[model samples]
Target: MITARREAWTGRVLLVLLMAITILPFLSLFVTALHPSGTYPPGLSWPGEPQWGNFLKAFQAARMGELLKSSTLIVLGVVPIALVIATMAGFAIGHLRTAGRNVVFIAFVLGLTLPFEGIITPLYYQVRDMGLLNTRWAIILPLIGLFMPFSVFWMRAHFVNMPAELSESARIDGANTWQLFWRVHVPLAMPAISSLAILLFLWTWNQFLLAIVLVDDPLKRTMSGALGAFQGQWGTDIPLLCAGSLLILAPTLVIFVIFQRRFVTALLQGSLKG
Candidate 1:
């Protein structure tokens, strides 16, 4: 009992330290953002008097309004359809005994190993050739495909563990495949679906590399992608830049805080089911 207690205490201390490490940069950024515009603080230090205007200045200068709209539109275009495709695919592979299931699952598993950076050159050329360059579709279309591997895997982990008896009973009621999926399985999959939605929203909203490489117009890019240009323009204005970054990070922080439980639940479910 004493040894176990010591181990538990050690784990608790490690967790606390890890949490602090994670939070430190954001704390530094928040503190730095409070400094006057154009001034760089030597380290993490609070200003004598806060320069609250820096946030407003950063917001307007960064064109956050436009970036926010573009990010929202891209996320909308990506998440729902991706979810639909991923969920259907997951259901087919996990619950249903479809032909070539192992081969298809292996294909998706291999897709997990593909690096996003490796495809950028070819992806850009393909997008340009297709006349999608500088458009949101350039980002949106590719992200849906890119996200599928992990998305389908996560959903499959859930559906695979569902009792086959559920499908058997549903079929006895004269339910077809479509009805079994739509009426029975989908409602029960809401926890997994909701958590996946939260994750995809965060990913699609914050996607920077694809957004930057594919789209040129800063206004059309994701808020994070636009930050590259914003930083280039305002790099000297450290406080303003930090403030703008914090602003860009706020929505995601709010979302994660709100849905953190669901996210944690998803992790737990995956572990238990797997």
Candidate 2:
């Protein structure tokens, strides 16, 4: 009993330490953000007066409204289409025993090995050739393609691990392939799909490289993408810059907080299946 109590106390202490370590930086950012603009306070130092209006100032100066709209459009354009394609491809690969399915799966696995840096230059030229440069499609199309490897892999893992009895029972009931997929599999896969949607939302929102590189207009780029240009313009204004950074981070933070339970459940399920 003594040993168990001691171990429990140690674990609690460790958890508290970990929480502090994780939270301190964000606390510092919030504190720094509230410092009056043009007054650079030292680390963790509180300003004489906190300027909560700095967020409004940053929002106006950065044209964050337009940036947010662009990000929403890109994310909406990417996530649903990518989810549908990845789910269908995963189902085909995982459930169907068609010839050449292994070859196709291997192709996608190879796609996972190809990094953004390796393809960015060629992608730029291709987009330019297609007259998509400086357009939202420039970012949207590539993001969908780039996201495929991981998304398909994730969905495929879920489908592959699902009990074969489920599929066998559906088949016995005279369900066609379409019915098997839409009626039987999709409903059961909701948790995994929801988890993937949250991940895709995060990735799409936080996407920086493609947004910055593909689109020339900061207003047309994602919030993070525009941050690069915003930084260049306002790097010296520490408080306002921090304020702007927090603004960009807020949506993703809200999303994670809301769906955190689903995310955790999916992760635990994936681990157990693996």
Candidate 3:
């Protein structure tokens, strides 16, 4: 009993230390962001007076309004279409008895192995050839394709674990494949779908490399992607830079906090089901 009690105490202490390590950087960042715009405070020292307006200054300086709009547009474009395609493909593979289904599923699984860095060069050239360079489509199209493998995999895991009797009963009721999918499976898959949407939103919002490389217009890139240019333009202003970073991070943080329960449910469900 004493040994087990000691072990539990040790674990609690270690967890507290780990939490501090994880949180300290962000705490420092928030503190630094509150410092006066032009002053570069050494280390993690708190400012004498917190400059709250630094965020507004940073927002205007970074032209964040346009960047936010662009990121929203990209997310809007990518998430819906990707979800639809992935869901259909997953349903076909998971629930249907189609020929060569294994082959098709393997093709998507193979896609998971192809990293963005591997094909980015070729992709750039292809987009250039198609006259999509420097456009939002350049980012949107590639992101959808890039997200497909994992999205399909995630949805397939959910569908495969769902009771076969669900589809079986629907078929006996004279429902067609489309009806079975839309009327039955889709409604039941809401939790997984909602989770997928949240993830896609986060991924699309945070996407940097493709946004920077594919689009030339700073206004057309994601907020995080545009941060490079923002940093270049205002690197010396440490407080301003930190403020801008916080602004860029705020939306995603807000989203995760709000939808945390759903996200956790999806992860737990997927793990148990898959």
Candidate 4:
């Protein structure tokens, strides 16, 4: 009983420390945001008159409504396609015994090593050539392509660990390959698939690099990209920036919080089952 109490105390301390570390930057941002817009203190004293309305100013100045709309559309567009493609590719790579499967898997693994910065120059030209430059698709396609490798590799690993006997049994019962995959394997692989979907959603939502490069039109930019523009407009408006930063961060945070339990469960179950 004494040992258990000590362990619990240790866990509580660790949790508090982690929470403090995670929240410190955000707290600092808030403290700055609450300060008077033009006369922020350098020494980090609490604001004399907390300007909570700076968030409104930041939102209006950044055209945050349009930015939010555009970002939502982009995330909505990319995530489903990425999930479907990754799921199919991962399943295929794992289940099929084709000669080039290892080669293909290796190619995907290599893709994880490729830097987006290195490919941006050529990718920009390619998008421009395809008439996708300046369009939302420019950002969407590139990000999907970039993230596919990691998604596929992870899904493949999960799928490969699933029992072959299940597929074999399905085949013995005369289930077609498609039927076996969709009806049997997919249901069994839900934990992995759910985990992947959550991850893909997070990645696509927070994507900034592709947004910066592919989207030149401010009206068509993402939340992250729009934040950059917001910074340009209200660089000195630290309070507003903080409020805006919190606003920008809120959606992803809510999403993670909502799905976090499922994410943890799915990942743990998938890994263990695999």
Candidate 5:
């Protein structure tokens, strides 16, 4: 009992430490943002008078409204389509065991190793040739494809772990492939699907590199993409820049907070399924 209590206390301490590590930087950013735009307040020092309006100034200066719309559109464009493709691909590779499924799965596994940066040059030329270089489609199309390796891997993990008996029973009931996938397996896969949705939402939202590189118009780029240009313009203005950064991050933080439970559940579910 004493040893168990000691271990529990140690675990609590570790968790607390990790939470602090995760939270402190954001807290620091929040504090820094409240300072006057041009000033560099000392380490963790509170400003004499907080510049609360800096957020508004940052918002307008960064064209956040437009960025938000672009981000929303891009996210909406990417997430659903990616989820469907990933889910179907995962179901095939992990559960259905269709002909050439192993080969396809192997290709996806190989995609996991292909970093975006490495292929950005080729991708840029390809997008240019297609006349998509300066457009949101450049970012959206690539992300859906780029995200597939991991997304499919995650969904496949969930589906493969589903009991074989369930599929067998559904098949015995004369369910077609579509009905089997839609009715029996999909409901069971909700936790994993919801989790993947949350993940794809986050990734697509904060997709900075591709957005910045592909879309020349900052307003048409994602919030994070705009941040790069925002930084370039106001790099010298520490507080204003921090304020813009925080504003850009607000949606992501809100989404995570709301869906945190689902995300954690999916992670735990995946681990147990494995």
Candidate 6:
């Protein structure tokens, strides 16, 4: 009885500690956002007034609608193309017995180690030569290229863990390479696909360096890019900055809430597959 009681107490204490660690920062941000514009002493009662309208002000000043549109376009372009390329590359590497499959896979893995800074200058000149710089495609294409190696590595692990008999059975059923992958393997890999899509969406949406380096126009900037601009414009307004950050965080939070299970499970499964 004593051990059980102690264990329960310990669990409760840990839970409370964890909750405080997670929630306190958000609570402080909320309080700061609610703080009145005027001066105040060291510490006292909550602000008598809350600038709840700061959210709308953030949206207007950041031009959040255009930011959101650019973010959506970049994510939409990157995720689907990255997934398709990743799936095909993973399938080939995992299943095919080609002469240089391992070498090719290693080459792809090497891409993961290449720093963005190393390639940015060359990429800038290439984008300029192609006349893609300052356009959404500049950001989208670079992000897809940057993120593809990781996706391929992830999907390859998932495909390798899947039973060989699955693809064999598909082949026995008169399914060709495309059909085997799309109808048989791809459907089974939906969890990994979903996990990758969610991650890719989050990364692309939060992309700032690409937007800053690739795009000079305000209308072409994403939420993160717009936030950078907003910070420059409202350099002294901390509440507005916090409100803008929270607003930018909303979509990814909503996505995680909606697909938390698949996102977590697929991430684990992809990494842990035999």
Which of the predicted structures, 2 or 6, would earn the higher lDDT when compared with the native? 2
* lDDT for each residue of candidate 2 in 145-199, tens digit (9 for 90 to 100): 9999999999999898888898889999999999999999999888888999999
- In candidate 1, residue 234 scores what lDDT? 99
lDDT of 5 by residue, 146-222 (tens): 99999999999988888888888989999989999999988888999999999999999998889888889998888
Off by over 4 Å in 2: 1-7
User: What TM-score against the true fold does each predicted structure earn?
Assistant: 0.98, 0.95, 0.96, 0.92, 0.96, 0.89
Which residue runs of candidate 3 sit more than 4 Å off their true CA positions? 1-11
> How far off is residue 15 in model 4, in Å?
3.6
Model 2 TM-score relative to the real fold? 0.95
lDDT string, candidate 6, 81-124, tens digits: 99899989998897755689899889889999998888989999
Residue 172 lDDT, candidate 5, scale 0-100? 95
Q: Give all candidates' CA lDDT scores.
A: 0.94, 0.92, 0.92, 0.84, 0.91, 0.83
Q: How much is the lDDT of residue 120 in candidate 6? A: 89
Best by TM-score: 1
Better of 3 and 4 by lDDT: 3
Runs off by more than 4 Å, candidate 5: none
Question: Between 1 and 6, whose TM-score is larger?
Answer: 1
Q: How much does each candidate deviate from the true structure in C-alpha RMSD?
A: 0.9, 1.5, 1.4, 2.1, 1.2, 2.8
> For residues 189-224, could you state the per-residue lDDT of candidate 1 as single tens digits?
988999999999999988999988999899999999
Give the per-residue lDDT digits (tens) of candidate 3, residues 83-157.
Answer: 999999999998888999899999999999999989999999999999999999999999999999999998988
Top-down TM-score ranking: 1, 5, 3, 2, 4, 6
Which model, 1 or 2, shows the larger lDDT?
A: 1
Candidate 5: pairs in clash? none
Candidate 4 collision pairs: 33-239
